[model samples]
Target: MLGAHDSTRDAGRAQRWAARLAWPLLGIVISLGLWALAARYISDVEVIRAAFAPQAGLKALVHLLGSGELWPHISTSLQRIAIALLLAMAIGVPLGLCLGLSPLFARISGPTFQFLRMVSPLSWMPLAVMALGVGEAPVVFLLSFATVWPIMLNTAAGVAALDPAWMRLAQSLSATRWETIARVVLPGCISHILTGFRLAVGIGWIVLVPAEMLGVSSGMGYFVLDTRDRLAYDELMAGIVVIGGLGFALDWLARTISSRWTQRGKQG
Candidate 1:
């Protein structure tokens, strides 16, 4: 009876795992079907049909991967994102802490920050290109600008939301300001920082394509434009797929990290 029960339990667990995976697979199938339908229905032109079909895209992607042509572009884009993110964190976190800790500073800079944050990142493209002179500099500048506001704002909000009771306790203990902040404030707000980091990542990525269109010889955005100029629609579609996949993967990573941190914070 014990052996039979254990077998049944294992079978049930396997069924649960299958059921868990089914929806995502079904969704992918439906998406592919729709893509195929759209390709066929959008135009009766054979060239368009052949270029836009999902199979054509998959084939192009596979060829690019197999030929190792896609890796460089992928690496270039990822490197830019990394640089921009590092710059954003360095600037945003400090500014955010000041904003949270100092009412006078927040009040003084509040309007400037608010106005700039409201301005769309793309609106700065012309100015950025002119000022930075169209290379990786301009591209990284735009991405960093797009990414920084969320990080700064969320960090400020997180710090502001920290408990006064905790602050009081620290003060009563005669803790130095630096010690209090290092020991108390930062630990309390990590989840919020992670949330903001995730938001910044999504915004920065969306901006990256347009930002890279300036004068860069490589990167996914450049590859996209090159493919279009060459009339390589299948390759363009493959780039789109790769971009979407990367974005989804990034967002997933951010969420996983944020959730894990939150859970760990709770456990501790």
Candidate 2:
């Protein structure tokens, strides 16, 4: 009976894993099929063909890899993203903690924050270029601007939602304010903070491409423009593929990190 139960459990686990893997595989297959159909039925224009043709795109990607030109673009983009995300976290987390802990602060700043958040980050591109000059700074600023809101708002919400009993318990134990915040408040809101970080990273990654277009000499965005100017549609498609793949990978990584943090938080 014990052996039979163990076998049943193993089978169930295997089935769950298979099911989890199947969905993504199916989606990829469907997407490839659609691309193939589009390549065949779409206009015979070279640009269109290059964009849709998997073979052409793959060839272009191979050429890019061989030329060693792609790495610089990718590196520049990633660097900008990393810097912007770090800046956003530095600014947003502390502000969020303050707003979350103090009702008066939240009330005073919340409306202004909402208004600022409502302003599209892309709308600031022209101003950013004019003020900061056209280069990596503008791109990093834009990405950070776009991403900071999620982290700030989520952190504030998390703090607000923390159990009141924890605060009371800390007070009863004569804990210092800093001690309470560090020991009681931060741990309670950690899951929410992780959630916010994941969201912020996703937003930052998505915005980085367009942000990179602000006259940067090298980045995936510039590569796209360069390919278009050179009429290398295949290369353009390859750049797009690289951008999408990188974005997906970043989001996946953020989610994985968030999951690990959540598990640790729960265990603690």
Candidate 3:
């Protein structure tokens, strides 16, 4: 009976894995089919041709792989993104914690935060350029600005969702305010905080490309502009593909890490 049950469970797991893999594979097949059909039927003047031409884009990707120039641009963009993400976490998490823990503070600052958050990050580009000058700083600032809200909001939500029983028990044990927070609040909220970080990284990555275009000479954004200037549509498309792949990879990595951490926390 046990052996048969084990076999059944294994078959179920295998089926699930197959199903998960099939969807993405099917999506890719469908996308490629659509691309081929569009390429065949669409007018040459359409952007779709330049965007999806495999031969041209593949060649451009190969050229980029061979050249040292591509690496530098990728590195610079990644560096700026990393810095901005770190800065956003540093600022957002503490503010979020405070707002979550103290009702008075939340009420005082909520309106101001909402107002700032509602304003589009792009709208600040001109001001960022004027105030910070045309450089990586402005780009990083804009990326960080775009990212901060998600982390902040998530952190606050995490804190708010903490079990009140834990706090009550800690107080009953005569725990000091700091001791209770350190022992109870942080650990309870950590999973949510990590979720926030994953979200923030995604937002930062999305903003980084456009923010890099704000006048930085090096980075994927500049590469895109350069490709356009030279009428290298294939290279432009290739750069865009690279950006998207990298962003997806980054988000996947972060989520994997977060899941592992959550699992560990549960086990402990």
Return the top candidate by lDDT.
Answer: 1
Looking at candidate 2, what is the lDDT of residue 139? Answer: 91
If scored against the real structure, what TM-score would every candidate get?
0.96, 0.90, 0.88
The residue-by-residue lDDT of candidate 1 on 1-268, one tens digit each, is 9999999999999999999999999999999999999999777789989899999999999999999999999999999999999999999988898899899999999999999999988899899888988789999999999999999999999999999999999999999999988999889878888999999999989998878788899999999999999989899999999999988998999999999999999999
Separate clash counts for every candidate: 0, 0, 0
Number of clashing pairs, model 1? 0
lDDT per residue (tens digit) for residues 150-181 in model 2:
88888888899999999999999999999998
Q: In model 2, which regions exceed 4 Å deviation? A: 1-19, 40-47
Backbone clash pairs for candidate 1 read: none
lDDT (0 to 1) per candidate: 0.93, 0.87, 0.87
Best of the two (1, 2) by TM-score: 1
Q: Which candidate is the best by TM-score?
A: 1
Compute the lDDT of residue 35 as modeled in candidate 2.
74
